[model samples]
Target: MNILTELAQIGNRLDPKGAISFPIYHSSTFAHPGFGESTGFDYSRTNNPTRQVLEDAIARLEEGTKGFAFSSGMGAITTILTLFSHGDHIIVTEDLYGGTYRILEEVFNRFGLQVSFADTSNLEAIEKEILPHTKAIFTETPTNPMMKIADLHGIARLCQKHGLLDIVDNTFLTPYLQKPLLCGADIVVHSGTKYLGGHNDIISGLVVVKGEKLATRFGRLQNSLGATLGPQDSWLMIRGLKTLALRMKAQEENALQIAQWLLNHPKVTEVYYPGLKNHPSHATQLNQAKGFGAMLSFRVKDSSLIPRILKSLEIISYAESLGGVESLITYPATQTHADIPLEVRARLGIDDCLLRLSVGIEAAEDLIRDLESALR
Candidate 1:
């Protein structure tokens, strides 16, 4: 069977009634079979049948040894950072998501953990920033907003040479388009709220570990931190995942059309989508992943046109989040990457004129007309 077929078949074994839809185990705790024995789940935080199903599915899809589901994407990121000690340092992609940057600079920095931002697209830049205390390389391929691609296999090899953990945020491309673990990452993380959730209905995060030791460590941290996803949300994630392969295919198709249209538009100054032949990392992306994914960013010729364009959009939504079933646009300078210092944002080219688009499962022609109307 195909992976799409396999995804849709998740949780069938758990449906004792043959209802097709998996039942949500809503109980907070499982009953014990005996005084000294338990039914595998003692508490929801430690383990829940519904959450476990979603976790297992993600692990299988990513080809990892184990999986973890968290309350939110940030929760998963925070928990993963706990694996490092106070003095341990990390090298991260300079153009990664704003939330990740905020967490590292605002939350973790006070705890004594250090971070160095480097252009991970440039292998030499990454090599130069590795400190003696550097414990890991955290990066986002086809990075948030900017759509900057990183050389996953190369970075993984470099990490191995220095004994550093290779951590990748696979939220943008997702496992359907790219599997980082298969390309040599040690751990893969996702904001299930976006693509994996598919509907913008639930906020969740996922972690998949490449080995048993890392799985065991993450499991312990998840249980101890009590940031696990609830039964209902877990069920939602499972449902959303069932149609992910279909959703991604449609969304990527829409994205490519929009990107090409934008490249020739009079108001557009630049287009950043890895699918484009002229993209800086187009060859590397083609070599590492199955597709360019449905995320793209472009810069308008004038910053003054932004307000009018945002207001004129009919089919597309001016929103903060991405990877849903509806086309959404975001102003990264104010909305997503605002947490970064102005100088840093400028350096990374996430300026006032840049707009990020998360294409949906809409007809490509309709989306193009919507953009045309907005630009007019």
Candidate 2:
């Protein structure tokens, strides 16, 4: 059976298997069978059946052996970074999500860890930057607001050659669109607060590992940090994911339509969308992703025009976060990327005029009309 059909069946089974949604296993401690015995779940801090079910569902979607849900996106990211110790080094995409960039620069750097930010798009740059101390290569394709695509397969090959780990932030595309593990990545991570949750209500993160070794390490760190997702939030995320395929398809369609429309607008200087034929990663995206994705960004002719346009819009709320059932918009330079230093922002090309849109499952014509009015 096809994926949608399979998903429907799974939903049906879960609904009748005692409940439509996974119940919050509210007890903090699980009863042990006897002395030196276990119920496979001794405490909530370590594990819970509801969290396990959600993790299993995510793991199946990502096509990985195991999955872990975290308290938030940064929680997941921090845990992954904890895998590397002091004196170890990592190569990261220069254009990372500002929060991740901040954590690595401020917190991790103080702990004796070393890092280098490089433009991984150019394989030569990556080759020149690798050193003996490098322990991992961290990357994000369709990175943040700039939408710069990373070569996952190429980087994965390089990671293998250097005996380094490969980690990918798969939040923007979600498992419904891209599975980095299939493209040779060692691990995949997500801000379940975004697409996986679909609605704007909850916040969570997920990490999926391809092997038992990494899984073991990740599990230990999860317990150590106490960043595991609560049962109630995990259940909500699972419910949101039930319609993942449908939501992604509608959002993808709307995004491409809006992107194509913006490309012809006189006031728009550039549109960063992998769906566009002119996008640098169009070919690679087609090879690796099931769809072009729901996120896109464009730069207006004047930075000041952003406020005017935002105020003019009837729909598409000006928001900090993305990947919701309703359309959302943000000026990354001021909002999401504000924490990054001016020099880094300029180098990453996250200009003030750039507006990132998370296209929702809305009518395409209605969305275009809103944009047209805003631009005018």
Candidate 3:
């Protein structure tokens, strides 16, 4: 049977139990009848039917051969990056999510893995930085905070030519909006804490591999390294995925209206949203993503104005994390991107006044009004 059919069957089976809404396989271990012989599951970490179902759904949605669910987004990334050895090198976008930048610059460096942050938007710059030790190219298109758009197809082509793995963080634009695997990426990673979970209550990560070989490799690491998502969290993500398309549609609209509003505001110095016609990546984002995505950023006319604007918000919460039923506003320089050095953040245009918003499925008019009142 097809994956969709399987998902429907699972839903149908659980519907009668009334447990489908939130099925809890709270056990840490599964009982096995005999040595090396099982009732299909030997351990919770190695396998869980609920987690499997979610993984299957993600794999199908991303059009990947298989999927691995992890404890967190960083967990998924670490698993993939761990595949390379000490001397191996990785090239990543300079404007990546700050957590990702921290991991590459801090943890990976200590492990003897050489990494270089490059402007993936510029092919020539990426080429200039590539070394013989380079084994992978990592990127996030419509990148975190900055909304910088990288040419996924172009990078994938380069990876193919060099026989290097291309890993794209598809968190900002979920499978519903943009499937990087279809664009030739070898691995598609997600901070399922974002749109995939939609509710923000669950912390989960997913990795969808392009083919059976890569899938097997990731599976081995996932099982051996043991960062698999809990059964309960997996169920949460699965349920959330059902409403992703719907939520994203509303979020895209909300984000577009809000971005336009910010652009016209006198106190707003600049808006960084691919939906805007003047945005550098507007055309490219349009070509790849279904919508401009729910994430947007803007800088205030003065750095001192930020505290007032943040305090003035009635609807959007000043917080870390994003992608939920409720909107969130984050000061990236102090919150999400704090780990990156001040010099590096400034180079990437993430100034102190920059505010990143993750629009929710709330009424666009209400959200716009909230922003208007805040900026006033």
Candidate 4:
């Protein structure tokens, strides 16, 4: 079946009444028929009727054995990290989200979890960083704002060879564009609040794991941690997912136009988008994913233009989050990458003039005009 069809059919199977919208089980607990037997859903935290539909939908879409939903993206990530032990070391993308870095450094590091940042776009560099205690490789391809692509297949093969788990943050490209599990990753995760939700209203997190043993362990951890998404939010995510295919394609179209436009402007020194032929990972993206995705970043010629561009924009919102229906522009130096040290941020090319744009499903011409007026 086409992914578009799969996305739209999210709640169809579960709703036996043929209702167009999936029913939300507001009841935190379900009544049992007998002492020894019970309905599959026992509680909202462990599972809920509405949440089950959403989880199953993502699992099938991502081609994983099972799926788990959480209250927030950070909660999902935090649960996944719990799978590791105190002495375990994890290799991660050098340029990743600030929140993930913060958790590893401030929260997890205190518990004795070790981390080493590697340029995951370079498989050899990642392999070189792996130590005897390295348990997994957590990668964000088309990494955060920089838009770097890592070779998922190669990373999977390498992980298999070393008996390491291959974990991928598939939040940016999403299952609509990239299925890391299909590429042989052991686990795939998403900040469903972004593209999966397609709207900025609800915060959500999703996880899909490959094997039964891992799924069982993951489910237990999820239940114990108790950050499960509420039934209301689950229904909202389902509604957001139904329109994801349409939103992603439209956003991709708008992004390509804006990226090209940015490429030509004299004030714009560099544009980082895989859709561009000049992007370092263009071919790799062409090979692994369905599209180049809608996220892009660029550097302006001078630091002075930053404030003028941000303040002058009419349509695009100056915001912190991405992957919504509206275009959002983030200043990485002080926003997304602010937590990283100044020296580290400079080394990663997240300078004062850099800005990350989350292209939306708005009209390309209007978006371009917004950029033009902002640039002026």
Candidate 5:
């Protein structure tokens, strides 16, 4: 069956009731069939029917053996970090999400996980940073706000040679656009709250592991951490996954149109989008992924235009989150990447003038007009 068909019928086959929509099994506990026998669900925290459908769907979509759902993207990330132990070293993407950086520096560092931030886009650079204790390389291709693209295939090669785990954050480009596991990734993570959930209605995170053993370890951590997604949110995520194929196509087309327009605008200094022909990672992205995705970032000619652009937009929202039905614009310096030190942000090119845009399913012409109106 086609993946789109699989995506649309996510919970239908799982539901014994033959429900067109996946039913939300809201009960926290299930009655055992009899003493010494189980109905497959003992408690909601450990597992729920509704969340199971979502978890299974994500696992299949990413071509992995196991998947876990979490309360938020950070929750998913935190759980993955816990896989490491005291004195375990990990190499992370340099232009990373601020929240990930915070937990690595403030939370995990204090607990004894040694981490080194490096430019994962450059395979040689990552190789040089590897220590004897290094256990994994966590990467974000088309990294948050900066739009740096990593070579998933190259990273996988290095990981294979060094006996390290290869993990990729696929939030920007969902499974519809890219499947990191197919490219040899050991694990794939996503802020399902973004593209997977489609709307800004719920917070959810998903992790898909390549093998059963690794997946079981994550499953144990998920239940132990107790940050798992609720039955309600899991159902919401199921509803969103149904329309993923359509939403992703629309978002990508709109993003490409907007990125092309930004290149010619006098006020726009530079545009960071893999869809653009001139983008540094265009060929690399083409080789590893099916599409370029909906996110793009551009810098204004002057920092003064920042406030004007943010406040002037009417159709596009001035907000922090991305990969939604509604268009959103964000300021990295003050919004998404603020936790990182100013010196580091400057080096990564996440300047005060840089504005990241999460293109939506809105008509391309209308979105362009909105940008034109705001840039004026």
Candidate 6:
């Protein structure tokens, strides 16, 4: 069956009645049959029927051994980081999501977890940064705001050779477009708040593991930390995921059109979309994923045009979050990557003139016209 059909059919087998939609279990704790006999769920933190269905669905979609859902993307990331010891180190993509960068620099660093930023796109740069304590390599391909792609297979091979864990954040291009685990990653993480959730209605995170041992370890941490997704939110994510295939297809098509239009515009200085042949990572992306995702970043000819563009937009919203049904334009320097120090942002090419667009499932021409009007 097609992935679209598989997603829409999730939880149907478990539905007690003939109801098409999966029912949400609102109970926090399940009643035991008798003393010392539990119903497979003792507490909400440990497990919930509704949440389990969503988790299993994601695991199946990502082709991983198991899946774990969290209250938010940062919660999932933080819990995963707990797998390492205090002195352990990790090598990460230089142009990562700002939230991930902030947690590593502000929270994890204070707890003695060390991290090294490297341009993972360059295999040699990753090799040079490995320390004796380096335990894992974390990367976000088609990285946030900048849309820089990392070679997943190459990174996976590097991890295997060095006995390092290969962790990938698949938020920007969800499993529909790219399955990182199949490309040899040990684990794949998602900000379900983005593409997976499809709508801006709920905030959730997911972690899928490639083996039973890693699944067990993460399961323990997920319960202990208690950042698990609530039953209602889990149901919401499941509902959102049901239409992922349709949304992603339409969004990517719209993005490609907008990207091509931006390239020819007088006010646009540069367009960064992996679908473009001129993109530095185009070949690598083509090798690893089914499609270049809907996220694109472009720089305007002048910084002064940004404020006017943001104000002039009618259909597209000037927003912080992305991957929703409605298109969003983000100013990375002030909104997304602001937490990064000015020096680091400059080094990563996240300049004041750059704008990031998260294309929606809108008519391609309408989105292009919106951009044209804003640019004018």
Please give the range of 10 consecutive residues that has the lowest summed lDDT in model 5.
13-22
TM-score of each: 0.99, 0.97, 0.94, 0.99, 0.99, 0.99
Model 6: worst 10 consecutive residues (lDDT sum): 11-20
lDDT score for residue 254 of model 3: 87
Flag regions of model 5 displaced more than 4 Å. none
Where does candidate 5 clash, by residue pair? none
The count of backbone overlaps in candidate 2 is 0
The parts of candidate 4 lying over 4 Å away from their true place are none
lDDT of 3 by residue, 1-376 (tens): 6433443443345534666454667777777787777787778898887888888788888888998999999999999888999899989989888889888888988999998999888878888888888999998888888888888888988999888999999898887778888889999999999888999798888999988887888899999989999988888887888778778878988898988888889898899988899988778777776777899999898998899889999998998898887899999999999999999999999988899999998898998899889888
* Model 3, global lDDT: 0.86
Backbone clashes, each candidate = 0, 0, 0, 0, 0, 0
The lDDT of model 6 is 0.93
lDDT of candidate 5 at residue 127, scale 0 to 100: 98
Computed on alpha carbons, the lDDT of every model, listed in order, comes to: 0.93, 0.88, 0.86, 0.94, 0.94, 0.93
Model 6: per-residue Cα lDDT over 196-241, one tens digit each? 9989999999999999999999899999999999999999998999
In model 3, the runs with Cα more than 4 Å from the true position are 1-22, 33-36
Model 5 Cα lDDT, one tens digit per residue, 33-119: 999999899999999999999999999999999999999999999999999999999999999889899999999999999999999
As a whole number from 0 to 100, the lDDT of residue 287 in candidate 1 is 94
Clashing pairs in 1: none
The superposed Cα distance between candidate 5 and the true structure at residue 355, in angstroms, equals 0.3
